[model samples]
Target: MQLEQILRERKEDKDILLMTHIVLGYPSFEANREIIRQMVENGVDCIEMQIPFSEPMADGPVILKANQDSLAAGTTVEQCLEFGAEMAATYDIPFLFMTYYNIIFKYGEEQFFARAKAAGIKGFIVPDVPPEMGTTFLKEAEKTDIAPILIYAPTSTPERMTHLDSIAQGFIYCVARRGVTGKKSEFGEGFNDYLALCRKSTRLPIAVGFGIQDKDDIKALTGRADIAVIGSQTIRLVDEHGPDAVGPFIAGLR
Candidate 1:
């Protein structure tokens, strides 16, 4: 099924789908596998797995450390794909790999798309690759039936937003704040206003991320976006208390 269809099903229930991010081999491959299992068992509507890279520019310290640790542990792109394939075979959920464009370029877009599609990955979010530079990969993705999800921030200009909305396939990742991918201060002023503007600009599902800590934040976002993506908070929970914490933390979200 398409990513939009999965999101639309969630919307029909009047519930915001939760899409959480994880880094494969963060603590260890075993820990990563358990975490993926925990997330699936915890009612996560979708999952975004990060392929560890040496330089994760958009991520904050916590995720950066996780990536570093995973890389130091000798995690490779091929191993990340293998892990994802395992999870995909075991669970029936939409999975998107979030990574920078450099990795794809390095691995060769054709090879990367082929491996990811074979592994049951439905989509991807390349934050650093703007729409202008994404055409080549987008074409490759379309051929392989892989959705290329786009990211739009609160500070995006009208032209940029419109352009992104036009090209976005799976869902538009609405960055809740103007800064990096992590918890933020206050969700910033005029947050909902920005969400409303994004809603007006695109028919695609919009999943808001960054600084989504408590149920109140999720409540505040009701009817504003199709999904609430809680990354750093959930990742922090896993880092602090291990994979078992996913159930309780997700219960808190509900």
Candidate 2:
């Protein structure tokens, strides 16, 4: 099934989808494989395999540290892709890539898309690449059947939302708050209204991320969002309690 279709079906079944994010080769490539296996067994609907970049501007301290550590461990882009391919081949759910625009640019856009598709990447979550500047990248992704997910911030204008939704496929990543990832998100007033606006702006599935920590946060998104994305907190959990804690923590979310 298509990525969006799978997400929509989950929503229809009244199941709140959980999308987990992990930095590929964070602790190590081998450990990442186990972490992903556990996440899947624990009820992760989708997995965002982040290719560690030198500067992940949209991420907070936790992810930043993971990126640094992964890079320091000599985690290359090729290794990430190989890992993604292995996971995609092994798993039944969607596997997406989360990385910076520079990584794709340096790796060659066409080459990147082609290789990612061949590696079993269903889509991409490029935090740094905006729709306006990512024309060629979007076109190439379309040709390769790779969905290019777009993000919308709380501060985004209606015009911006409409523009982004026009190009976004697979899902619209609704950034829970205005800042970077990691901090706890206090869902303020009009949260439902904001999600409604996003739904009106796009036909794609809406997955909210950033600052999503506990089961309470996941429950809070109940009918408002189609998918709940937990990133920094997952990494923090693994860092504090080892990979075994991953499945239990994700299980709690469900």
Candidate 3:
């Protein structure tokens, strides 16, 4: 039941999985749990539990605010782990941690991956730590069997894609655009070409995120991508309409 295997199975069935993101302790611990339950019930295939950090450079305005607000409300790393452990145990889908490298560095990579594995986190999305600078981190991840998923941006060179393809585990996170997460992506011919290039690079499941919004966005990724990542938009909907809105919104996407 490793994450990579789950993704492969989904692909083999020709099912495009929905991968959702949530900033841990964003609104509150209790609320976050309910939100996750709703998402799973709505058919979310994987969950990315983002550990709120001070400077989440890869996040857009909405998620950045969520991170700051969570920190302001005294949401510590231990609380996130506790929340993650509970959710991972409750949900059958793959649970991965998405955070900046500094959090892992400060917490000690070995200890961090070990604790994440213990807490049922099957993988990680360390945005700042590219493969070249992640030798030790990868070593620890391999030892713990925690997949440190790599990312491929639209701007990545062929050589860069080849390098990333070599080490990517569970899945490859393909950022749809050049900027941070949020906004709506225009997945046209150019975006299709980018996805094609990414597919050529890695045999792992390619998850397209960063600006993915509605059902049309998911439809746009139907054949080319294995997973659709919806982050900021889902958070916004939950914040505006409460966690109850999440299930229906995800259902609409499906």
Per-candidate TM-score against the hidden true structure? 0.96, 0.97, 0.98
By summed lDDT, the worst window of 10 consecutive residues in model 1 runs over 180-189
Give candidate 3 regions above 4 Å deviation: none
Candidate 2 residue-wise lDDT, 12-80, digit = tens: 766689999999898988889889999999888899999999999999999999999999999999988
Cα lDDT listed for each candidate: 0.85, 0.90, 0.90
For model 2, the superposed segments whose C-alpha errors exceed 4 Å read none
Select the stronger candidate by TM-score from 1 and 3: 3
- Residue-by-residue lDDT tens digits, candidate 3, 75-110: 988888888889889988889999999998999988
Cα lDDT of candidate 1 equals 0.85
Alpha-carbon error at 131 in model 2, in Å? 1.3
